[model samples]
Target: MATDNKTSAILHRDTRFVPKKVVGGKGSYLFLEDGTKFLDSTGGAAVSCLGHGNEQVNQMIKDQMDQVSYCHSAFFGTQVAEDLAQLLVDSTGGKLSKLFVVSSGSEAVEAALKLARQYFLELPTPQSQRTKFIARLPSYHGTTLGALGLGGHVQRREPFEPLLSRNTSHVSPCYAYRGKRDGESDADYVVRLAAELEAEFQRLGPETVCAFVAEPVVGAALGCVPAVPGYFRAMKDVCEKHGALFILDEIMSGMGRCGTLHAWEQEDVIPDIQTIGKGLGGGYAPVSGILIGDSIVQTMDKGTGVFRHGQTYQGHPVSCAAALAVQKTIQEQSLLDNVREMGAYLESQLKQRFENHPHVGDIRGKGLFWGLEFVKDKATKEPFDSEVRLSSLIQGKGLEPEYSVSLYGCSGTVDGIKGDHLVLAPPFVVSKTEIDLLVDTLEKVLKDVFASL
Candidate 1:
């Protein structure tokens, strides 16, 4: 493990902690410069869905490079870009009718927020009064200011809280593990959460609300937490009642990350505005996008006939080609089929290994994305002291030579500063054998970590 690289020139994510140098990567493993092979269980914060150095996606990037690498979206659009948008629309079966491509998950979320605001401005009556947004607490949208404003992740938003949008408010997240009362049934808990959302709308003056944005599955901020059944439908109904848009930020959980093209597919409601990335380009290129519903498309068509948003690198030909090829590869190879099958296997293995473990308080997730929440006192569900930095310690241990594995460790699951959890989201193409190795290595890592603590 490499740390405090005073001699290095690069300013990394954690300046004080320069991680091990990865020389190469393939399928579900990464090769470090020291000749150690690490099982990429979390896919580098769940970004490398297809794993590293996929040849078909790499070839598509090369082919697009030969043609035209970058072109400003203001002047012209490439056929590859057009085709990628069409593919996304088609994949939605016309439920979502248009696309606004961007370079990253944050950009996609920024685009979504802009589109929601503009969509309102373009409506027949032009509801300029609709200026407020409501998102779920403990949810993560992205890191850009606008996206960050919408996110309720306290730790990520702490420094930027002063700059965040006051118009965006947060409601209780549908986190049954923590929110559900001891004797509450799932349905009753959902109803209470829905009522809380409704109350937030009424308090905000329903006419002034623009949208209710949320993640179908909570990602890093809360560890792969999926909403309870019928929870989204209920929340969407409240939005419809208030004449507010129902937006879903699927940037970290979409593009087949949740065993479906869109995470909302599993739920009954399709979002009026959807943001996607991560698996969209499968780490081949930088890409993310906003999918628009017919109502918003019609509004824009009738009003400005244009979306009042533009980015220098939006819809780059090379990026679109890479995303399209990655998507096609997922379809052609039927990787999502493996996702479903191996998801069950991964879930079973995680539960079998962690369910009875003293520190593991909760096991949650859907598809291949799973998280194990650790507790200092299992019966009380008390978190380890944040000072101990349990999650960070677990993550750092994972990178050690003895562990030689990668897992996503996160804290503050209980109020953005109290609980701790770790996630395992392998590539869609991962096999049962790889899943076994990942879980086994993680179990070993946990043993060593807890013993030290």
Candidate 2:
């Protein structure tokens, strides 16, 4: 069992005071120590797609435990792991090169980085091959050292700047709302962004860059923003021309969150290495992994006959069982269909309620994920003063009385330190009534906070 230390020794992300203790969870709500239930709008950073107390997922875990909780992969293989891998490969149309599992998104990312480097090494381009990683500014991959370096969240990287990788660099994210010129067409804006990526590749010498990493739908960073039309295809073309790998961090945007099994399917491009998590196990277990493209995997299979990387928990039996159940549930129930239907309803509801609101700057998202940008002036799209902590205030307001909402606060949408946004990612199984409640509560909370401002 874990032992409790002194409050100061806890070393929480925020040290001002203690956070509320969660005692239990049930049906899309989290119960706190004092018995207050929060609506769970953010689904714990968009992880709990199945929501709290999903019986099927829980039963799958229990069954796996009853059979065999774990066994070292070095000595033996588990059917659960093999089946899950087969499921994933089948879902991707048998095009995936390999599936490397890990315990978390960060681990998945670390593996991908090492795998990319290894791929180059095996191809004899180990020396002249690209060694640099190019990701967009304001994007986040994960929190570990390698993943952290790949991420561009300034605030998160500030304290760890000295320890981060110098091999990684940032470029502009294809955020049309903020990135588009005053009168630039969407197509022109995509071209401009593509040009920026090309320039970066040229600047770094294309052969020296290992991969171009991006979140197909910018998650956590720019608030579920999908690229403008032709943006991804153009970027993929550029990467192909440069002989660089395209790695996508879909930890928050894939697995039907964007109305497709893989978000890349909607973008008309395929990543050489795709990192997925959160929805993979639907928060039933801690699991994330990399789905490799045919070329990279084939190169390694033929050259080394073994991957040079792995984790202790790689292909964990219990985690794989839970994830397999989650995947099966999504497929058997056709949850992606619901994601599209309910996503349209949620988008329409948000637009109807906030599109013309005085202080609401933007409402954007895909499927069940969404974000609301708060601003002081709608005409100028000037965000609220960060000092006011408008996002926090709205979040606090929503977690009152009977409704509990987790608002994901984001800054730097306007710059690296000035804007604020609230992300809402409810469960995939959410009903119209529940969505209405979320919309109503969010509307009320925003209004109350705006009035206070």
Candidate 3:
């Protein structure tokens, strides 16, 4: 298994990168082939909430493999999937009781989009009345054709514009830091965002709108931006008034990442269809799924008598087992408290390190998921020129000698192309010492980069 170095066949993230092959991981560190250890601060795009190589989760996977490796959802339903669904439903207090299993976050999001479409089809309205979806600019749902269409990330969609569906419409995201007008109060900002959504539905003909898609806490696209108070409540009202379903994509922001089991819980609103991943399986396995409310399930239950769309690996046994164990660990061990505690510590450390730094314009996020927004001018909140690629620069600098932190890079936070942000979503099990060290390492790297500039 070792010798054939015949030009790697896999498509690396960066073609120029001969990335040091990772040999193994333990705790929060990833070990490379050269025996170098790097702290995985971003958890590979925030997926590994439980950190690497947890014995409990590993053991659970082994037990499941020994008992039963795979069970096709079409002809059979495994106890693992059933139990996992039950646990998730109980977590939601039965609000979202039905489940649709998928292997990835993108798949989960695709299911949500289809489910939302189906939800509207089940409505008494005409087929043409339920064909449009509303999403926010600078947002990301997933990468599949359907989910990508639902997303508003300009750069990601630019190449696929001709192929994407034309039924989707865009609205301004609730990004108070960048979208809120000057002199606008929090309430006013929320109202303005809601009005924009309402207007979008109107422009698209409210009757033709199937659902409104959004992230409860904007992840990746806007760098963990949360909405202003009452924002979701207002948006939910608008959707309901228009006879449209509210679909929340919490694939990156939910499942205890935002100090609660669900990000929507903090918004004082619940979606008709919810998409969750990342923290769901804590990266112990490839697990992501849709949580369906009673209304949507009842519609399908009474109309088609079966969910029309499904996957071959839906409710995968091993995936379900790993997820169930991860969920149980999060609950039984009381990890939410750690998320809050460590999150606060991380926030304080970040503020102490970058609050007054000239280029560090914004330090925002909740729980352990945080972001650092770089700027050329802090007063006007002007972003660093896109050519500078501050996020990428910091990422590279972080991995240099004497600094082994891995930072998540993102672009287009401002007006879809100008801003740069580095997101840090460390494992929920991160310690205060680790938080301190991470912040210190980040501050040093920032200083070095700024000084060079």
Native-to-model Cα distance after best TM-score fit, residue 345 in candidate 3, in Å? 0.8
Give the clashing pairs for model 3. none
Q: Which residue segments of model 1 deviate by more than 4 Å?
A: none
Off by over 4 Å in 2: 1-10, 124-129
- lDDT score for candidate 3 against the true structure: 0.86
TM-score of each: 0.98, 0.95, 0.97
Model 2: per-residue Cα lDDT over 1-453, one tens digit each = 012334446777655645667898887788888778778877888898878888888898999999999888888888989999999988889778578888899999999999888888888445445689999988888899999999888877889999998999999998887899999999999888889999999999988988999998888777888888898888888899988888989999998888898998888788999999999998999999999999887787777767887678889999999999999998888888988998899999999999999888888889988888878888888887778877667766776654467777777667656788878888788788888988898877777777887
lDDT of each: 0.90, 0.85, 0.86
In terms of lDDT, the best-performing candidate is 1
Best by TM-score: 1
Instruction: Count backbone overlaps in model 3.
Output: 0
Report the number of backbone clashes for model 2.
Answer: 3
Candidate 3 error regions (>4 Å):
1-7, 124-127
Rank order (by lDDT, best first) = 1, 3, 2
| Colliding pairs, model 1 | none
lDDT of 1 by residue, 213-325 (tens): 99999999889999999999999999999889999988888899889989999997999999989889988888999999999999899999888888999888999999999
**Candidate achieving higher TM-score, 1 or 3:** 1
